[model samples]
Target chain A: MKRNDFDFSQPNKQSYAAIVFLAYHFFRILVRQLWPVLIAVLVGRENLKNMLFWIIAGISVLVFVFAVISYLRYYFYIDNDELVVVKGIFKRSRTNIPFQRIQTINIEQSILHQLLQVAKLEVDTAGSKGTEFSFSALSMAKAEALRQVVLEQKSKILPLPQTSGVEKISGSELALQTILHLSFSELIRIGATQNHLRSLLIILAFFMTLYNQVEDIGVDTDQVVDQINEEVVYFGKIAIIILGLMSVLASFTFSLIRTIIRYYDFTLFRTNDGFKIVSGLFTKKQISAKDHKIQYISWADNPLKRLLGLYDVYLKQASSSEVRDTKSISIPGCNSKNVERIKFYYVSPEEWKDLKNFKISGKYIYVRVLYFGILPAIILGSLMLFTDFKIYSLLTALWPLLVYLAFRVNHKKWNFAINHELIYIRNGIFGNYFKALRLYKIQSMALRQSIYQRKHQLATITIYTASGNINIPYVHLDLAKDICNFVLFKIESDKRKWM
Target chain B: MEFLNEQIDVKGLPDITDIQAEKLAANYLKVIFITRGLTSFIFITGIVVAAILLKDISVTIRFSVAGLLIILFIWFFSLSSKVFNTRSYAIRQRDIIYTRGLLFKSTTIVPFNRIQHAEIVSGPIDRFYNLSSLKIFTAGGSQSDLSLPGLLSSDAARIKSFIISKTAQDEEE
Candidate 1:
């Protein structure tokens, strides 16, 4: 730890403690895939209890033996400029990851790992040929030593890297500056600010999917529903209200627990040339998003978060979408000041003023409102007029009204700003989302228009970055073209590397 | 760092609004129509046969279905012509632009430096006509990639080499 550097040129197997992790992983996968079968055998009509017990014991022992063998087989070493991993028993295979392509080295610590004072190190590379292997168990000092070697600025890799993912989390000492830290109160506030409505919607969707699956499996869902309905009617509206309240309460509690587990004692630090975020409770994770690799920075607040004076900030790094999903980092509960600091570190947010501003046409909502709102409303109205379902009229009136309100909110929140260096998009409804990107970072530009938009002289432009994309919908056709051309010019003229 | 945020004069910049984009080979239109026409004819003919043979479907409905089959062919040919005209490509000094589509029209631009790779491809019919397409890949992944079909094989090869050279120059820089 004091040296901050060590050698791993000699091949060595993982720590003996790795067997515990390997066995845990093997058993977890077994239970995850066979839980239903396990339950069926246990509760089934057949009395083959002795056979089942023997089978379980046999599998467990076999799993332990396999884990031990795997642990013994796994060997890693640094050979030249590549990190080499040689593993597998019968079907031998080896992987070589160059230090240049190794984009990020992250650390994770489960409860067991923490108790054993060991950590899991996951190595993520840039492309589809990703080296997404991990050491299931390694001493913290050894993992740190490996990271130190790989992340060295002057290490032998082709065309020296501009920004390295030099990082610090809880243990290994490295040069890092504390940017922000969340107190216990802030964590609670963050949990409180989570959108319970969204969580509830997801839960409802999950249950609907589950019900459909059960119905497909020959269950009499309608009969079950009728019985539930009868019970509900017998209990009356008060009981229904209580049930709704309980579900809402359950969703809120679920959101809070998830927030705490994922972001307990969150800390953001500024490394020499990048941003490092360390978080989690039982499975501690630490990742660094290098300055040059970060393609876009976004921050937003929901209605609740806005009330609490906090914003959730996300740094999208350069990669394909699949890799980006694992690479990107989101920091919740950053106040306006913290967000500004983060934004400043990436791009000068203050320089956004005096830049050209563009608005998505008011007609943007017309297609949505007409198709999604009014058309359905009109269809339902006619249906109600033709049929005896009088309650449908109320529904017909209710839908368009909600859509129109949403339209009003969305219209207020849609627009973008751009200058020679940066593109800032402001969007969202009832809250605010700001996505800031550098013009030169865009990998491609797409200008789109539907027939209706062409008739109205409107167009949309999508600027694709390595991480994701920013779409400005229904701007003036000419404006979209101009923005596209300007971005292309910037990309061509600029010599700076996007990654 | 000097004047990095200078106000961009968009008017002075190169505009792709009315460039003389190179149209796809004319005979390739035959390729497009031939393939689509064959598929449409087979399906429509099958439906026509079904319409004529089915006794339970009724006369008015059968005749209307028969009428729609002809109209569908007419509509398909007309739409295909319009779409064929919309497809064109232009190469700038540092980037390539592809203009395509009729209903949901789109124009995509990919800078050479940003392009990960480019390749020339030809289907069997395309090979018969000595026509190939150039696909430009970027780090932005598949959706943002551009594919320009209906080019002469020589032209496709030329464009692929040009793109490769440009990207290689960036690496050298």
Candidate 2:
């Protein structure tokens, strides 16, 4: 269908498919709300049968009526260059978003929407807390037409140079220029390399939930624990080893399944304007941010990922105050060459090569040791003098060694650099993290000195960007001041757009 | 990269310490004393009420607690006075600099172009004294990056207008 076929001037309701979507959502919510009653019916099956039937029937009818009412009440259209949405059942709200203020119009299609050939449209405005307006379901044709009209109006206001001819290209032709694609094996590698501790904790939490549910069903947990203890004693040390190995295997499998589901058919494509990443098995998320909007780019590789030659690259864009994780696009399973390619797009290749590195002051090591080691040691030693935890006193003896190791690793990892308009900060111990941002993108800068730092003539400089703030902690006061001045000078002089 | 290779003359650059910032309003000290005095009065009243409620408590213990609170309040007032004296702000052509704190000193520089908005607000006590506070916000975060309290209402309005105009001009560029 042609884009001009839709009558955008008149106020209109969404496609009838929206009612189906709303009904599905409302039904899900109703089920969640009635979960306690459902559990009661499950426990007292014979006695509550009639009550449960009536309750389900009443809730289903109420949810259906509510969803239909909500669908009927919602209406949106473009009026006087503003996207106006009038919606509500009782209170009634009219949201008028000026075309010039719209930051982005995101279109998403869930499985149900895809089946119905409908899309969910979300309009985001700059300076607002979150999504300004959301239409749960709209016809695909109308969604595209609305997006084009909004973009046209935005271009009229901003006068941004159009990166034309992108729409004409077919999907297959665009796929030919795929920059990064994670194969099944690579996804497996990423899953296996994930931090085992986090996966173990997730597994533990899952079991804890089950344990709680069992307790709620009147099971004696103490009896279960006593039986488990008897089994453990009968089986002895090998039983503990077997259990540990089994838990480790369970975590690994869980992580593998999660990665498979999340990153299935992960693909990144470089377009004329910027990069496009399409991933997710069920949700099918498509994220595209222009190159200019990108404020920072960072990549990290843990020891396991390093062995497999894999790193996760993150592109952080200028975001509103919400701080949603969606502001950044993370592409895992990227090799070193892919990382270089991605960096080349954001930063100039020559500038990337000539970054002048500087190490943080060694005093950071002393401070870290004092806080992480000596203080803990003192607390534990004092506690041992009062409490009967002699084992904790023995653990106190290990603090000095821990402090030494931490200081060595911290000193080795902490470093930052500058080159032309770009500032590079690299830190982290087991995982090597590298972040780079343009100096002009910094919104503000601060130099902080604690009493201890003041005595040592050391200070910490923090540079705030739209995505997040970066800190160069425990640097020589003189050097920090010089860097701050240079950064401010660059920010004041540069005429380029920050986002 | 060429810019990094070039040497930056640290000595030639304007140092925050050397900028010679202007102090807050002359009555700022008086304002602080009044506010602190009011707070301490409330705190002492609460303690006295508690002591009266607990009839079994000895008079000596109650008197000692009161004495300790008074001493602590005096010490806090002196420390706050020192901190107030250290508070200062400087306005450059392109940015505003604010420095505060007696122990953990911090110097914040927010460029004019980066400011999202500026507001001039006066509280009851500040209004009584004809003083106002200028708050400068940035898109970098939710909190205002620079908030300078204890300015004469007129000066606060002037600064607020200047910042608003600067922000508008920056947007144009």
Candidate 3:
């Protein structure tokens, strides 16, 4: 540490050590990726070329050394009013953030950082992407001490009570809440149904690619296909086994890497402002919002997870006018009991009581399942019938179609919602999500009557919240308008500050 | 900031007087009904789109869509004229009120301190008729954020200046 430059506000040694460790591992991974090219060049039977590869490797090593030096040299200081960071090579850049604008401070440590006994500090402000400032790798104790100091300084400038007059609970209570809500089974189910369908399809495509690669390298593609078609694959059993194993391993590796990167040691901590979420391994992320920033809260419980009483909750926060796209932050694997507790943080008990519980009308479920299944089947069947195909073509298509229809039916059966304290929606087949959002956060309301709906005297009332839009379909048109008017009246009449 | 303590205590918000409510609710129904014309124009465009998309449908379907479109157009025109002539305002000890709706009546009450910004806007239609709309913004995230619409330009200007002065005076305390 630079003793003279270092003041009481500077980070401790553990933080620097952690950053150095991170840089070391990252550099090592980079070198490993480039190793094969260097080995190929070295073994090309040209002495001069081999020497060039060695020189390049030497340069890479030098770069690694420089990266470490930079990480170690970087330092920051916190004054009463602002946080100043002095960092760079060749030219030092000093960045200052005012204390009053400080939104929240997050402390995060991944498994690697945990092993190193270091934690990272991130300071987030409104409208800033990621944290405005991050203090890399410090001892957890020192990180907490520094965090406390910063918080104290910030409070002096803002002078607002940390939690806006909410009850504060012990860490043990938080830990219990975390454990009760965090369901591993739900996470796995979520992993399965998630956008991973795209990945699963991609993985299947990758397998075909690998299969073609093997064929191009010498294996006979025609013989392999013929064997599978004829059910006579004795000649290439060993090769088939090897290929199957390779594909499985590759897919598993892809899934594992994706899951690790997206949700490595994800944690949520209750804070005075709201909940703080910390996740990520390589490029860590932290998000903090006050209760008022949240526009809607929703949750999902999948079929298998529902059996195990597992679900996930998400808070959709308002989009800043400066940025059009907004995202929802989720606390995955939450149990049913935690949903109410989480809602309690944002709404009063009386307001919570006003939320209406809505279940998918049986007629709607029938409509959804029929539309999802029969419509596609009819369209595909007609098109296929018009084209050249055998009698069994429809039957062959029936397999995936039937499976999808079953899933759709199951999904629609489970979707429901209510408007009481907040509007709560429960959706999904295997995993159930119960989400409740306060009405006051809605930016606009529209009662839309489609020609089909109008004939039925029904309309879809869409509540456009700051974050996103939610539509309650097939309600009586007059009732929808009445509800819309009621909501608009209440929203305009309220004097509460949302942000 | 201390000026807010003197203008009107915000703690008095919950109980609004009937006179204040009536004052704010004035011309609300007329303006709301008139705005239906604007909404009908928008809705008719959807009917035209449907007619084009579902061309292979029966004559009855086509006739129905066309009829709905024509009816909505007429409704829009009928309401448009009435909206301009309507106006209303209400006042409570803690807040001011405004209400506007046609068939479905809606009312809005804004506390004195809750006003973040206010604007008086006029378009070609309003300019021709000597009418303006007052849009008041608060910090909250509600879509019903706008308080009143369809006022005489002069009335809107007076309200804006009054609110501004009131805000300034409240801050002085």
lDDT of 1 by residue, A332-437 (tens): 9998899988987777555556667878888978887888799999988888887788776877878887887898788888979988788989989788999999
What residue runs in model 2 are displaced by over 4 Å at the alpha carbon? A37-47, A161-176, A203-243, A324-326, B1-11, B36-75
Question: Which lDDT tens digits does candidate 2 get at residues A1-499?
Answer: 1247876767789999998888888899888777766776677577577877887788878878988999999998788778889888788988888887786677877788899999988887876763376789999988878888877766666654322213423111233358899899889999999877798899999999989978876789989999999999999999999999999999999889888888888999887557887787776766676676778899999999999999999998877766564378889999999999998876767666667789998888888888888888988798897888876787797997788786778689988998666899889877899998988888899999999999999999988888877889999998898888888887876666676
Residue A247, candidate 2: Cα error in Å is: 3.6
DockQ of each: 0.59, 0.45, 0.06
Interface RMSD of each: 3.3, 4.5, 9.1
Top TM-score: which candidate number?
A: 1
Order candidates by lDDT, high to low: 1, 2, 3
Q: Residue A318 in model 3: shift from native, Å?
A: 5.0
lDDT at B156, model 2:
92
- Who is ahead in lDDT, 1 or 2? 1
Quote the lDDT for B104 in model 3: 34
lDDT of each: 0.83, 0.81, 0.59
Best by DockQ: 1
